[model samples]
Target chain A: TTQEDPHWATPLSSFQGFEMIKILNDHPKNKSVFVHGKFRGHEEEAVVILEKTPFSEETLPFALSGETKLKVGLKNDIYGNYHGTPPAQVNGIKVSVVYPATPKHLVKYSQQQTYLVQETGDDYRNITLPFLQAEAFRIQWVYNILEHKQESERIVFEDPDKETGFILLPDMKWDLKQVNDLYLIAIVHKHGIKSLRDLTAEHLPLLHNILKKGQEAIQEKFSIPPCKLRIYLHYQPSYYHLHVHFTHLNFDAPGTGVERAHLLSDVIEHLEIMPDYYSKKTLAFCLRENDQLLAEFRKAGRVPQKSE
Target chain B: TTQEDPHWATPLSSFQGFEMIKILNDHPKNKSVFVHGKFRGHEEEAVVILEKTPFSEETLPFALSGETKLKVGLKNDIYGNYHGTPPAQVNGIKVSVVYPATPKHLVKYSQQQTYLVQETGDDYRNITLPFLQAEAFRIQWVYNILEHKQESERIVFEDPDKETGFILLPDMKWDLKQVNDLYLIAIVHKHGIKSLRDLTAEHLPLLHNILKKGQEAIQEKFSIPPCKLRIYLHYQPSYYHLHVHFTHLNFDAPGTGVERAHLLSDVIEHLEIMPDYYSKKTLAFCLRENDQLLAEFRKAGRVPQKSE
Candidate 1:
């Protein structure tokens, strides 16, 4: 059955015979056990997630074992996840192994995600423009990748057209495992289009091409259909390169928050109606307290200086 | 100390002598057990949350109880929560019990959140406006409360200005226990203004008054400074009549997703810059698949007919 089916319970149970590789994460309060280990007799590591189920009506009543009873409260009892964390209504740590482990998986699973703010058009003109003029963000690595000097083998699809073509590859954040938490990036061959602000009616064709081909390629490789894909672009992206993110609708990938992510379909439609929509519109986003962009805004007195 | 302090681990522990009240939620996979009991000798209920702490670097390795080993894999290994899940990096569920939970608290913490889509101005014109014209939503209860026919004692703040004044009351979603997951709604004293669409430059005084007085009132009572609060409005709001939401910045309240939430600060600024901003601009929001609004969009041919 497809992993997207909400009722499908992950199948890799019984770690009794599994060979251990590395512990990705283990926690008690916000409890999770992520291990990069191989199921016994397997050649390489398989991506599996282990979680200690909550005490459900069926299982929790049997929880007392004569040992010294200890107590706890997770550092974060956060309950605001909009994605609707699954109904974890049922004990021992459950396990389900997926794909192979990669170095990228290590970093992706480890670090915390950054919270972003919306940067309005006023911000675009007043702060983002000046920040870009200063060329504060570096994209040498993007150029290197486009030129095939780096991560060349990772490309899943490539359209060599310099104007509308792009190289599709697994983002460093994707673990190259099964498709549920899938993430991939498509970088356009064109160099002048640095970010969302650089797009115009002239680049709509390029955007469409990425949207179409990126979705098509992922489906071709992973059997996920286009309708199931969530394609979008990031404004004030981590890098200056013009790239598109392709993720499964079920994945709930990061950086897709409304404050930062602009749906490619909405954007294409916007530019369709007004060719200069991006050029004239005010975009919004959050700037970190210590970010250079925030500093630029503060320097111009558009944002308040740090009182903290 | 203020509950907003992230450095603080929740204080109430040792359910040891606590009188059991009711089980709010209990789960093994999603791993959360929310109880609604009170401290043993206390007269009134004080909120507390209990979570089994994870096996920390200092703890986990000693987890061998050598009991009957059962295993699992939670139904959801969801990793892409946009709101960062704290570093759950380290075993038994820990426990934390916060303020006395109200019936509202039970409702608030029970059901899962709904994922929303950004509704553009076109949606407002084609689907939302038409839906509103049909008066598909119910809000007679609001009128009842306004007339002091119901829940009169719940009003936290009220200004009698028909055009500019409003009444602040705890949203049924707030437990009225503590300030952290605080949620409140302010309904305008005037009745004609239905939703965000009805506002024009003429209402800036009202908007400004709500922003100023609302902030002041909350600060006066809760000690949460303006910067510590998140004040906003929801498009396609559950009920209309132009209500504004006031929540603690740290609460991570639901319906605050970008697609649905509009910052009061941004709204005020937009109106300040252009009186007819709401009228001229297209606002976007998600319509549930089965929502009456979606039916309106499809009937108008503004959205595709569902094949499903």
Candidate 2:
């Protein structure tokens, strides 16, 4: 749906109708899969005729509907074949194996049983199965397309396909749409500079160095550093996103109920858990975006402007 | 109520019976208008118990009766003295001009009606009669007591003619209770150390000086800083009561609706309304307590030699 339209109208096109599927047919690409779809049907003009109560009164419209399919096929290089890879025949997609969004064994099992579905083609050899439930899957796809830049030759389901409507494939291996806003609260040290200005000017790069050191320490100390800590430098409106987010992926596990809440508490504890001196020194590395922007202007071309 | 009481027994005594109250005759050293009462009820206990519930309980407990009215009271020096001076009848009677604990101005009003009642045996004289019609007036007494702690005295009602509660004299002033465990947050710049250990030094007088400075700053910053801020320095079986709390006093006015949700917001804004540098420095003063404590420890004190 286009946000500019009064009704936020969406357009519909077929699964085979998208452009990304053509790229999937080319075998040399290292990417694994691609999907695309489009959704249409909204009364934008009719909304203009009304008093705006029918549309503008609520954050989300009271009534809206659309249908789109996503076709996912592996790239030629992924399977070492010029054509599509042989489809993995499954009775129902095991959600845990595909999604793996949550950490709990029971939730993963339940999600596998509840959300997955096995779609059988006429020949059954080319059957398609999905990991997420119908509605959640659709929302995730739409959100992914909105976040990623448009490119014709990605592995994710891009553009249109025979089964789904107009949409784009996401570049990340995991779904970024389902993620909650992750925060890293760092306590600043190196006395006399409590304000944001002190942070970006002299502290953030120091923090980045500390964090890199800490990460290395963890590897050396534990002898098993994570393969994918999935740390990202995020910039947001309020926090200025100076902190680096750490998780399995960018996404936080949902449906963990008490576990998710506990995890949040534990993470807060861990961040503050550092020895007082180190904690303060490391936290100074994180800075708000506005402060970071100002610092960047002040330090332009001299050195990399670190977000405090 | 005792925490160990399995029956969840509530005290039979009305708030007037709390033992801490002092009769007007007992106070010869200081004289002013004041009254005090206590309700050692289980409201706080019940809340604590409920707050510590297990996450998967699936349901929350409904509050039983006798849970309300858990607050203490003091005499209202302002509205009760609305007539400028106390009536002759209030002599020696432990009388407190208490506004009901409910929302302020939740009482009814008459546009063009004024009535007078002769002062005889009635507790309060020449009250705005329209308040009787308002449902919320019944509980307005709580705010009155909390707001005017300085003007109220803790007096026990006594009568030779008929043994009963203490009497409230015309001239009495009261102070809030000074509990041994309570401590006020203090910020002092002269302390050479940076942490909690500095306060625990062998030089008690120096520690006292630091505390005095912090207290003075707190008073200079606010019109009426809380005299006692209870602290639980250590939380557990052998808990140390070393924490500091900033006392908060809220008064309800005409615009304060029955909800009173705006009280905290109003107080926060009021605190921030001070001159920018002063307010920031004051906030820093409060926040620096933890850092100051740590700083003290960093500069190790002289260790006493082992006994020969």
Candidate 3:
């Protein structure tokens, strides 16, 4: 079995006298090559041949905890299913090894992650998570570690990525998405400027010009009614950047909110993809989607009601 | 001193013995005019003179308790002293009406206020304070309320200036002025769109053109920057609106932070101001400010440290 698998590495002789042994590596499990017995002139070495196992939960001498963290080289053996049944004597023992997941959490590109902090200072060993995203990690006991008492002190983390890792601090912010048409509103939030005044004076004219020009450039394009869009500017107090959320609510349930939200998200995502060079079709689609979202919000009564 | 004031309206004398008095009117302090009387009749109104006393602690008797909110109105009495007094009484008890100083926790334009509601249903009475220029009446205990519930909810108060009352919620935001050179960098925790590729290729060119034109207009007219300038651009997960903050730090002291903050706040406040017609000076100021902020952020290491 060992010869058949060229990627296997030999095990250490320290396995002697152990009824159950477990071996873990940062690299993918497939590339690991295990050998037995000490090499020439080596006083300490293990003597055994590692064979591939068929089942994960049984048969293996040691049971795998499945708590292993990912690190470099973790991908090679990621496809294998081997359960380790380490002897009960290893129960309270702690073993530390660098894993691939450590660096991934430290610095990686993913929407699921908010921020990452690699170990810098000796005092705080664990990773740092912002108060907003920390809830996902199930670490509710972080409040116990604070010593100072100022309500205004901000925690700045050192981000190896962004020159300064401004530490993560807890903030109570209103989620605009929670209020009305989440997708329609979110698209507006993407544009930093708020208010129809800003939109007409700044975004609309430019956008119109771009769409008109881009429309001419593209082979297939559709006409759009500019006045059909109504924008309501909202200042997000939680976010540092002041942005305007465009609201184009239709009073009747002409469209479903779920579909509208998906369409809006897609349209905004498309807008973001090429903000400077938007095609006329893109503008037309966005206008069409926004019109639909407005209708949905109006039907849902999510928009604030005004007395005549 | 209370007898000679010409503004006093004599109280009715008919209801002299009545222990309970109730007056309902639209005016605040003048809503219901009542006087303690031993008799009950239309004639009792003569004894109830609305003699405005030298308002003081004696004029209003109430404790600043758990949920008792009052608006403190102060005026210069005959003695030239600022005498403060409660504007109204609820449940026959006078309460101190005061607006709290802006919270120390928030940087700029961020504060939380709580209105106590004695009842639940439609009968619930809640007086809301508007967020505007400093008024004589202020509310206390603002930030402490939002600290517990990490959500955004606001109490709307009627305003004569606008058709509807402004919605003021607890805003937890960062002020760009706090940083040196009036520049800010934010780490966007969204997936894909790494580097400046998304911004420059898609969003930047258009924005750059807008900003350039704005600066040119500013320079061509006022020959100076608009009063206090600010600029922002959205970047993702950590921040749904990733942005850069810029300010004119040249004219202010190195650490005063007040001017820079004002600059950013002003720009955000008036983002829609005459959007079509920005002066050359204003445009130049805004462009320079933006360039400075971006340069500062890069210098401060806002971008990824490792060059791929």
Candidate 4:
């Protein structure tokens, strides 16, 4: 039965028809719980992704209203430990829900397809450099913000210095709650500087300023200290424009994994030690199965082409 | 109602008694398919960690018996794409199952407790250095292997050069299958190199040798190419012995995370640029809530201690 979209590996109606039989399997991560059941007289298993949906504009006002029913419980991390402030004993928790999940959520909750893509200095020269040059990633939104055309009002901190200055603001994905998954991004004011590859000892001041002031801004605004923040950058960034990510140490945000994440501290250290560190070093990272760079590598015969 | 052990949040019997009411939620990462179910009219959601129990000496023969039932199907990865070898379409897949899982299975399958423990050079000198020196980690098994006193039959590669020599062999956890999750370890012969901190430009020869020969040995024996193999080392490794790990890129075996995993290539590059790169750079890794290092950090006032 060929269908329009192949993503629905099993039919939606089949899942709706599944009758609960017994307890089969479950886990706490992303609240994934499984039940064994029967479907149309065949011993079958149905997958129901029980996710705490994100809050949207429509749901936010309603949820805050008195009309909606609410139950509050202290949320403990998977370790059965509460992350509490010492004096107040206040634990950090999350509570909210929205409807109709998306594919990113599914990808997020699913197992990561991360792999190590270690390459020599020459491999970078041959494969990655060419891929970056040929790729045309649309980052107009970034330009709009940088040019003060859009999202300008939301900027948390900005230094107008072209060389060592950057604009820091809360990432749009964050819910604007300082306590819940604090996320911020710092876009450098310097143009022509692209990804981690372009960074050298000359750019150490910019990196240092971003780290220090980014943390200070968040600290002054939200009371989160420097140590509690996890700051890093993504290689092969979503856009060619340079940016640094500042997230709470506890927030397992996207692009924070080893395959992509290069700590700002480490970057600074590397540059301080060797002015041409990034230029000379071999860079390694994972390319998703669907990544365009991977396709480029396949074309270059560096990575084997996908089989039929 | 606290029991003798607080780890079991809810009683085990309660989970067994849970009755499936409806098909509610589920996911497939760890196969956590859930049903909107009820237990004894109390409206309970039971968590059953369906895990493939490892094969022991007792269960191995029974599972392979002709009398037992068997089911075989083509396995597809999360992307709905075959991780097939070009021309062969023989995707790398796992087809073994066991029963009655353990507690670590629950923890492993649960959300990772990893956090970035980034510390500056001063922090390392003040806190981490003392911690490592003061702590006593038992590693008699490491010595037994190096001395050819135990498990010497499994040694896949060895070089007896005292300064740069090492032993490469299958990790004990690997089930002797060269295809499925091929895991190998290389333990350095030179003593006193406790962790990544001890590495310097002088040890570049050793690291380079490990990289070259370890990849060659696996390629020769298992037919796995260097590009397809993921190799790395943990900063705060499970043991104090200096060792390197070689794994199939397809295998998401434990400890491949950015918080802990540092590629040998990157390490070598860091050293090549700066002889004392590791010593001067700020290091960070996640410390689990229950980890002794975290406790030590708390005791030393580097991290705030837990509140009641």
Candidate 5:
């Protein structure tokens, strides 16, 4: 009855009280009021509010039906103390907040949902649109990662001008199991370019520099002679990032086919003659059944829908 | 002077006399004559003839200075008996003819020469001229081989129409060590059809039939399901003879790249749509530094003269 007294409201844990406040705040039309009730499982009496409505004897049971007395008490008390600093201890006993454990199934379901969402987004970017549009999203993502230093651990060499760099990363399928069986992802840091198709005569100097510097670094780092190296790029890359692959010459890597792998030197020379050579040429590539780009190609009637 | 008597001339082994006669015959300008000489290291003497020239004691030493008496005797006797059958036994020693053993160095050199000749010829066929011209020689070689059944042991299937066939052979480098790790060379026995480029709508039915029958045969022979099979062909094949390669999909055999390998079904579909699609389209492929075709392309300004 003494509304001015700060102790008039029941003490509650911060978390529970905040949840109650959140529920009330979500219903903006309701005004604050007192509710008197016994929490569902306990003999202790407590007070709660739903807008300006007070809990009468008849409505008490419904108001405190599912939650335990301790839970209800904690919620209402926290809600009452919202505008003020909450007490560290309630009723002389140490007040602690414990979150309910999430079920294993729920945890797994949530994770799977997140993964599915990410995968679907990737599919949308990779398969639904033409290559140029698809490449925009890919280049943005790569630049974002580079800017954030997300791949710091993988960075092997970075040129002072930030125009070129290399990352020593392992391929999903290694052609060989030797210590030298590593893939050097040589990246031209210039943005917007998606693949060899985008390279032009303007990029020749940069390309030449990267190849020369990258080879030197590889030779020094791995103690492998230039003769032992094979550098090339795939037309239809696993992902749309302007990257050249450097592997041991003896390693018969997955995409090193003459049809698929354009030697870096050849690519540079090809650009030297025709700045838009790749853009004008009709390129061929392989696509797995599930590949989104393949579907896009099929939709455009560029390739047959039926696979062989 | 005792020329009429059969025993007047030394009873030489027919092979030795034939050798002497061959030497004289090779020098067509040298008429038939007789020569007498002591074998280089033997005490025996013999006579030989060259047109009408007669051998005398004074010239014996110089005439047979390099040969044994037995050799010279055999040559003269065989020559004298050219018009009539010579006795099988000579000097009571069965007239056994012994051939000098070939030198080890000479045998090795001859083998190397043969291999080099074959390699050079293959280079000429594959790289020197445009694909169409090069294919002419290739067709002729294939015809010769088929006529003579040069690779009979490798022939797995031969159609009665003589227009289609299969030869199972090992790839230069195998991706796997299994018994079924073999390359099925599917040949269209039509001499002028060099590759997919030469395929037209008229050839579609034959191409489709072969693909189906070939797959069935492969399944039956290897016990591998159709799912494991990958069939395709190279545009500018390592060699010009038109053939499709069939291998386990798991095997990443050389030349199975987008730039090179054209799926048989795709070829058929393409031909169906445009009878001369391949012929009209510009095909791209890689050539090593030593590839003769690359040089030709460079000379024609189709590609640059650079190796990567």
Candidate 6:
């Protein structure tokens, strides 16, 4: 019964109009005649082919001279569901078809028509996606520096919080003087957390310990008073790891601009008031033109595409 | 014996020349002729005047007409010493004259003639000298802030060693975050010691105390680590007061550039090695176009005057 089914006999639709007949008859010298139609709720105009032979009036739902075939392509499932790869998973994509000439609704339907579809999974990878991967690799390299114990000698102080292992070390490059011209960095041991985006109110105690322990160590080591010290974090950090920067108020290190630097105290206060503050907030930061993350955002419809 | 004084007679030659004659004869109506020439060992051109009628042919070694009179006005002493006030008590100056018409050798000599002299008190003051006075007033205002105890609440730390009383306070304007973004200014009680030039090995213990006490206070208050702190001083301070700056290394504050900032530890170490290190050093700093200090330096021959 499944073999004799009318749906299996031909790949074309049962609805036959004069345009369908004209298309079939006009292209007799050819094996197939392609007609435009919406298939399986996919409103994008699809090309359906009509075979010149195997015409049987007894089995056919429409009295046509030939059998029809739905040429929706191999990647599409039987129900005309598109399972092909997409540009990205985050946003919907628009598809269109331009018909040159068709007899059905000759004037009104002669132009172009478009449709939308939701993207998923690995479909999101694009040419710019490689850049995001490269950045991830860079962050990985910095993380490995700690794992290898290369900075063990440089560690000025450390807190024994196994969950958020905090450590302090002098920055490698210092433009300020060596005596009181001290520059230091504080970082967390949690590898899962990347930046402020991943931080929440629960991590407040760890941050507090880092700042407190760091201040104590700096006072003991460098002989700088608390009032003279400045501690803050960069919004778009140079590296993706969760870290804090401690510098002298007089040093004016790079990335201390209002747009980039976020004070640790303020961040703490903000979190105290609103637990998910950073997560809900829309952050603005400078990005190089070649940054693939920006391209991915553009492709996902999260940001507007740059003009040529 | 005073009547035979060679200095009082012509105000001319003990120094010989005819450019003196032309200077005396050119201003015919005036009884006094002011001609610039060197007197004493001082080489800067001094204003000298010659009188005509009192000229005894016996007193005058050279012949001159009865009509020739060149009497230069004087606020100077009989010994040719200037008593006018100077901007600062340092350096010597050079002066020159350009004559429009004279013989070829005299003309050539006139065009390039220049002499040097030590400036007397207040003799070097220009119209812009008022600015230097204003800056002194500004320093006095800051000093008064400490005296009146206006910053008592803001005084995070203080070390009383009588000779070098040290007090630390927050900088009024701060670009760094306040949590750890505290900017402290540590000033010496001895206001007479204006800059690093006044520092010597004798003040090392006082400086050491300031750093230590300030650090202890900061650690107790803000909980920032000593490794995270930075401390330094500016060479040509914004004001004429000896002060050290303590801040976080992350903050890129004004006057932190290599040309302006000097490390407190380096300064102390330098003093330990050489007591007069700062004073002996020829410090270079940028002066704004309108800075009165630059004008004073030019007048003192410490620096060359820029051509108009």
Q: Write the per-residue lDDT of candidate 1 for residues B1-308, one digit (tens) a residue.
A: 47785422343323345555565544332356565555556555533334444544443333222221334212223221111112222234443444444567765554232223435567677667776878756778888888888898999899988889999999998998898778889998888787888788899999999999998999798776665567788877788789999887655576665556777876787677667768656565666456776777667765555542
lDDT for B38 in candidate 2 is 28
TM-score of each: 0.58, 0.16, 0.16, 0.62, 0.39, 0.31
Top candidate when judged by DockQ against the true structure: 1
Compose the digit string of candidate 6's lDDT tens values, residues B78-175.
10111111111111111122222234424333212111111222322332234446655466667676675576777777665667678787788754
Rate residue B75 of model 2 by lDDT: 12
Error of 3 at A89 (Å): 40
lDDT of 6 by residue, A1-308 (tens): 26765321232212222122112111222222233444343323333322211111121212110121112222111112111111111011011112222233232222221111111213223322354446553454455446644546567887756676677877643322232335788878777666676678998988888878888998898776543556778766766678998876544455554335666765676577568766644443433334445555566674445532
Global Cα lDDT for candidate 1: 0.62
Candidate 3 lDDT: 0.22
State the displacement of the C-alpha of residue A65, model 2, in Å, after optimal TM-score superposition. Answer: 31
lDDT of 6: 0.47
Residues B27-122 of candidate 3 have per-residue lDDT tens digits of: 112211222222333332111111111112221122111122212122121101111111222111111100111222111112111111111111
Candidate 5 scores a chain A TM-score of: 0.52
- Top-lDDT candidate index: 1
- Model 3 chain A lowest lDDT segment of ten: A73-82
Answer with 3 or 4, whichever has the higher TM-score: 4
What does the i-RMS of model 1 come to? 12.9
**lDDT for each of the candidates?**
0.62, 0.21, 0.22, 0.60, 0.44, 0.47
- Candidate 1: TM of chain A? 0.63
lDDT of predicted model 2:
0.21
> Which lDDT tens digits does candidate 4 get at residues B218-283?
879888777667788987788998999888776667776566788888888878877887887877
| Candidate 2 segments exceeding 4 Å error | A1-199, A202-308, B1-308
Clashes of 2: 73
Model 4 chain B: which ten-residue window has the lowest total lDDT?
A: B83-92
Task: Report the C-alpha lDDT of model 2 over B1-308, residue by residue, as the tens digit.
Answer: 47875322332211222222211111111111122222254222110000011111121011101111111111111100000111111111111122221222111110111111111112111121122223223322322322333323532111212111112211111132432222232222222322221123233333333334434544454333322211111111011112112222121111111111111221222223322211111110000112322222223321111121
What lDDT tens digits, residue by residue, belong to model 5 across residues B1-308? 26674331232322222212111111112211122323334433333221111122222222212221111111221021001111111101101111121232122112110000111223334444354474353244355445545545545665545555434433422312243334677665656566665667877766876788777877677665544566778866655666778775544455665445666765775576558666544444544444445456556554444533
